[model samples]
Target: MSTTKIGWIGLGTMGIPMSQQLISAGYPVTVYNRSKDKEATLKKQGADTAATPAALFQQTDVMIIMVTDDNAINEIFTGKEGLLSAGVNGKIIINMSTVSPSISKEMAALCKEQGNRYLDAPVSGSVKQAETAQLVIMAGGDAAIFEQVKPVLDKMSKMATHVGDVGAGNVAKLAINTLLSIHTQGLAEAVLLAKQNGIEAATLMELLNNGALASPYMKIKGDAILADNYKAAFSLKNIAKDLRLSKDIGLSTPIGEAALKTFGAAEHEFGNDDLIAVKKYLDK
Candidate 1:
């Protein structure tokens, strides 16, 4: 493995734990978040901090971003004092944000023009998975670059796969999340039906857990919903965003469209809560 310094941008639910995995693996990591408060926590955990993205980029050859959306990505990468303002020769930039495929392609082209490699490497899994380094990372980039970064990626992901060239990662992510959103909503409805028909929510979930329909998502999220614990593994609003993305990506997804409406309502009511809160919309 090359002694390349790792730079992390973003410290939200997923980013914090993912970065910590790299640090715990003994990588020299420098982190930057728009909100500087979390930087102190990460700094105490053996990671370095920079006041700006440009400053962070100045000190590292490999940068990983896990910000919220395209707007955040634009501001952090193209705004004043952004990464592009810094010299980027021989740098590898991996964007793990859940943005549109087009933007990833554009970012990759721009970085290529500046003699840097860029990868759209969004992840699948919730915060718990992130903390446990069990994320499934879908990467889209040059295969050589993907190979070079696989070791570092493995520190944060149980599976890191190069799906294809630029834009493919987000495309793959959108497709996956379409099923996720619909399935989550379906789970919500099942809980609602169980509760409404006098069957205990816990019993229904227990039966589902033993059946072929159960998944890792259902096991964790099902228990959370049964307990009315809305603490987010994945925020309802974020899943709603992904639902909208799936709809907009040129797919005539009627099921996704319906799921989007259900999640959209739940997001409006409990946007910051766990996606399991979509159950709140189910009975009402």
Candidate 2:
């Protein structure tokens, strides 16, 4: 029953659905996006649309940003017409993008200096999970602030946890994405091996799904691979970006190296395709 007005930036796949959850829950929402056309649909659904980030921040108590990367995040929050220009006093900024922990820490510090609260709140899940509000959100920031936003976070995710202090959410996201990359690559390699040895790829997937090897990702993405559906539930290029971020974290990842290379190549060839499309590279 909190009357906090919400602001949303970014209108990409996950951003759209995540914001919809808030709007549907009867929260007053003001939204802004780089492309104004994307606002058309939200505007019709009882959400207010702002012309710029500064304008959106003016009417918002909590702003949820779900942009692509760190660069995009910096652009909207620091320029002449950015969020800071309007003052962030008493505002809570939650960043839910996959980005570097270092950058998240830097933004958190800057927001703190301006008397605002910040959270590094990256999410785990793909398009379907987002649409269903089943994402796992890992948030990092002050414990009190996290408690303040947990209800709002709950409306957008199945589980939202305060993992640690500032920057910890990105760290958790990178580690999770590393494992995601490894699982996807391993699955692709196995399917390719089966196909090459006269075993049907679909058959192998069926067996795997019914056995202890079954995973939510394997079941979902494996079906997509089997049907040759690469409609970008999660793009190969983004996974490559996450893999690069994982490496930059300075963790030793001998297994991830090969998976990264495979995904890097898949990105080079099929950047916009679904991550399951890595199976195509292996099929060749």
Candidate 3:
């Protein structure tokens, strides 16, 4: 069993399984979520629960955050009864949320002011990867602090890479998500074109899966399209948000612009569905 005490914030789709990985690895874990009901699963797995973010900080040495959007990140850190409210020192805070680099830098400054350490460590896999402990973690922060938390991070990921100083992880996450949007949109377009010309969806998926263009993403999402399963593993709305964040960070190429427009249009009806649901939108 590892000796580092971990405090986890946010218990959404990805957070619950990721924290469970640490617990399975035998590190003591304490979790906090705005919705108290979400804490039950981890608590059942021998993990402790905290009433608030500040209270969690007091109980743990390393704090891991995985929430939705920039506003939620801010609320968890600086809102009433937040981590800084605990006035703790030397606590390492790793934010695994997909938020903007600017907000990460701002939070890092605040953490530094309060004599705490901060790392922006956003991940590259969906809920499946998180559940299986196969996530790819791109982290940004002090190199030494990263090494200090590497063992703890290892329990939740296949690899944890320190990309650069604060906010680089957010930049890396946005870049990869941009490509994910383009790739998924392209796959949807290709399938639609083939189906319109009288080719079967299954036939095209088989060809794509066996050809040089194959990938785990293509396989899984293609199967989802075949089964007509539009459940949200990674939602269309979140990708739209990532594209908007990429635009703010100066992603203005022709392909990027088109992808942004395509996803923006799809956000209304299919936003809550899987990103592969772009096929349904385009087929409409």
What is the per-residue lDDT of model 1 for residues 1-284, given as tens digits with 9 covering 90 to 100?
34779999999999999999999898899999878898988989988888899999989989999998988988887889998889668899999999989888888888888899999999998787899999999999899999999999999989999999998999999999888888888888888887888998899999999999978888988888878899887889999988877777875768878888888877878999888888877767
Candidate models: Cα lDDT each = 0.89, 0.89, 0.95
Q: For model 1, which pairs clash?
A: none
Per-residue lDDT of candidate 2, residues 23-94 (tens digit): 898899999998888898799898999888999988899999998887988888887798888875889999
C-alpha RMSD for every candidate = 1.2, 1.1, 0.7
Which of the numbered candidates is closest to the native, going by highest TM-score?
3
Q: What total of clashing residue pairs does each candidate reach?
A: 0, 0, 0
lDDT score, candidate 2, position 185: 86
Candidate 3 lDDT by residue in tens digits, 53-166: 999999899999999899998888888999989988889999999999999999999999999999999999998999999999999999999999999889899999999999
> Model 1 Cα displacement at 30 (Å)?
0.4
Q: After the best TM-score superposition of candidate 3, give how far the Cα of residue 183 lies from its true spot, in angstroms.
A: 0.8
